[model samples]
Target: MNAIVIGAGVVGLAVARALAMAGHDTFILDGEPAFGTWTSARNSEVIHAGIYYPQGSLKARLCVVGKEMLYAYCATRDVPHSNCKKLIFAADASQSPKLDGILASALGAGVTDLVRLSANEVRKIEPALRCEEALLSPSTGIIDSHAFMMALLADAEAHGAQLVCNTKVTRVVRKNGQWAIYVDGSAEVAATADIVINSGGLAAQNIAANTEGLDPATVPPLYLARGVYFSYSSVLPFHHLIYPIPEQGGLGTHLTLDLAGRSRFGPDVEWISEIDYRVDPSRHAKFVAGARQIWADIDPTKLRPAFAGIRPKLSGPGEPAADFAVLGPADHGSPGLVCLFGIESPGLTASLAIADLVLHKVATD
Candidate 1:
């Protein structure tokens, strides 16, 4: 079978690889000049331990399973990654109850290695961290997202998958039990395939809307949540990732370090109307305040505005968080087609698992 996977983000690349491995002639399409340029490139790149998400949700299930698969793949593929672990802590006594709730949720999601740490235990592990209590997630880690995506593309190409860049799919239609994809770029191009998978990330809903024969009501509303990262100039004293209790619509402004031990704080949720990558310098004060909650000695002068990324969210302001939507023929009655929506946060960690699920959905049909 011939298959087409739209959107060349990490998830789309992984899906294309899975399809090619399943004996399908797969074509990976992206509008960007290079792969992983959008949502895939702009993320925390943290491997979640299936925490924070509700049990039985796609985010919880996939993140837990995918983290193991990702670590294994990185090791065998020589992708640079670190199992640096993470500490989700309660900065104050009042937040301790919420930390308990988080621990319960993580345990229910089958994350068995979480260790609850007392104040002294937390200090022993991270001397610079100030927290009443913390939960240590041994499975949570970080990866070089660029290298990871490159490895996935290499493997997909090795399995006979073709990646087309600088091309946008203007329209999709179903005819004669196959999919017709219309592309517009330097030249007008048309391609037919046996299956179509829309993993468009930020543009998923638009792709679904343009897909003929699909129900419009089945497509959920898309909201863009802009998150900005502020790089810290000085070396951080802590080694592991430090997170405060999650706030509404985000995991709070936490600290994450790159492979070179440079720490950065960010991702305060800001609802945006359109796609914008510019980072606002005014948010530096807020970041400083947020960072001071966890680390008492954070230098305000060292905080500099870094790049930002927009999350394709399903829920808007004041709404509850949404689960990852992997709509298939079963949901839309469209044979050999799958639409992915609201794949943010753990989407990176769950890329491989999401690919497997997409392949299974198409194969069983």
Candidate 2:
């Protein structure tokens, strides 16, 4: 069977690898010049330990399962990663209750390495942090995202999968039991495949809606939420990722360190009408305030505007968060077609697991 995966992000590359491993001729098409130019590259790069998501949700299940797979894969592939744990703490006594709730939720989701710590215990691990209570996630870590993506792409190519860049898939249509994919960019081309998987991160909804025979009602609305990061010029005092209590539409502005031990804070959620990656210099005040809640010594003057990334959200501001939508034949009555919607935060962590799920759905359907 021949398969085409639209969007060459981390998830798309993983799916292509899975398809090639299944003895299918797989091709990955992306509009970007390279893989992971969007949401996949622009993130905190934290490998979540399946915490904070509701029990039995896709995010929870995939994250727990994927984190394990990722650590093993990184070790085996020589990918640059750190098993540096994370500290999700309550900045004040009033937030202590929320820490307990997060613990319960993480336990319910099968993350067993979480340890609740007192103020003194938190200070012992991260002496610079000031929190009333905290949850130490031993499994949470960070990875060099570009290296991981390159490894995935290399492995997929080794298995006979091919990646095509600078090509935008204009539309897809079902023609006589196969998918006709029309693409434009470097050259106008039309290709046919036995299966088509829409893994387009930000433009997933647009891809689904453009399909000739698909139902418009099945395509959920897309909300673009821009989150900006601010880099700290000074050295970081803590070795672990620090997260405050999650806020509406996003995790609160927190500190994350790259492999070089440089610290940065941010990703404050801002809802927007269209795609924009520009970081507003004015948002530094809010980031500074949020960071100080975790560590009091943070200097506001040292914080500077950095890059930003947009999340594809199904729900809007002040609304409930939505789960990963892996629509298959059961939802749209279309054979050999799968559409992924609203895959945001843990999408990078869940890439391998999601690829497994997509392969299972394709095989079963």
Candidate 3:
């Protein structure tokens, strides 16, 4: 049987690897000249410890499972990653009570390793931290995202899956118990198998809209949420990743480190109509204020503008966040087709588990 995985981001690449390992001939399609250049390449490359996701959601489940798989793969592939741990602090003295709730929620979600710490304890772990209270998550860490993606691509290629960069999936058509994916304008790759996994990420809605005979009304809206990051150019005050109490809407700007141990802060969320990578230096003052809650000694002069990434958020602000939508033959009534939407934040950490999910969805159907 033959299959095609759309979108060459972390999730797509992971899916391709899983399908290839399952003895299926697969092709990876991406419009960009390079893979993982979109959301996969941007943001803090933190391996979440399943702290923020709600109970019983895919994010919570996959993050915990994927983190284990990711660490295992990194070890086998010699990929660089660190379990440096993280501290989610309540900078506001008034937010101390909320921190208690955060810990309870995290624990309820199966992150039992998260424990509370006093301000003095926090400063001991992070000598320069200025929080009144915190939650130490030993499972939270950072990874070399590029290395991880390369490893996935290599594994997929080794398993006989092909990656065709600069190749766009223009449409989907069904014929004779098979699905044919149109590329550019002239060529088409037919999946003789009865499964099509759309790991299209941001472009998933458009791909679903183009799916043969899918109800246009059933296609949910895709919201664009832009996040920006900045790097600390000088001496780092802390050894571990530092985060603020995350709101239900977004993970607040937090200090995170790369594999080289350099510190950077980011990912303040902004909703936009289009995909924009602009990092507004004007927001430095706001970041300085927020960041100071964790590191009182953060040198404003040492901060430099960094890259930005936009999430394909399925829900908007003031509304409840949407769960990871992995649509399959059961939901769409179209055999051999699966669509994934609203895959953000924990998407990287959950890449491997999400692959398993899509793999099972295809196999069980």
Winning candidate number (lDDT): 1
Per-prediction TM-score: 0.98, 0.97, 0.96
Which pairs of residues have clashing backbones in candidate 2? none
- C-alpha lDDT (0 to 100) for residue 165 of candidate 1: 98
Better of 1 and 3 by TM-score: 1
- Please give, for residues 1-365, the per-residue lDDT of candidate 2 as tens digits: 99999998889988998899899999999999988899998888888888988889999999999999999999999999999999998888899999888888889999989999999998888999987889899998899999999999999899899999998998898888899898873233378998999999999998998888888888999989998999999997899999998876668888898898888898788899999999989887888898888778888889999889899999888889999999988888888899999999799899999999999999988
Candidate 3: which stretches are off by over 4 Å? Answer: 187-193
Please write out the lDDT profile of model 1 over residues 254-278, one tens digit for every residue. Answer: 9998888888998877999999999
For model 3, how does the per-residue alpha-carbon lDDT over 78-180 read when each residue is reduced to its tens digit? 9899999988888869989988888888887788898789989987878887778888998888999998999999999999999989987878988888888
Candidate 2, residue 135: how far the Cα is off, in Å: 0.9
In model 1, the clashing pairs are none
Lowest summed lDDT window (length 10), candidate 1 = 181-190
lDDT of 3 at 261: 79
* TM-score leader: 1
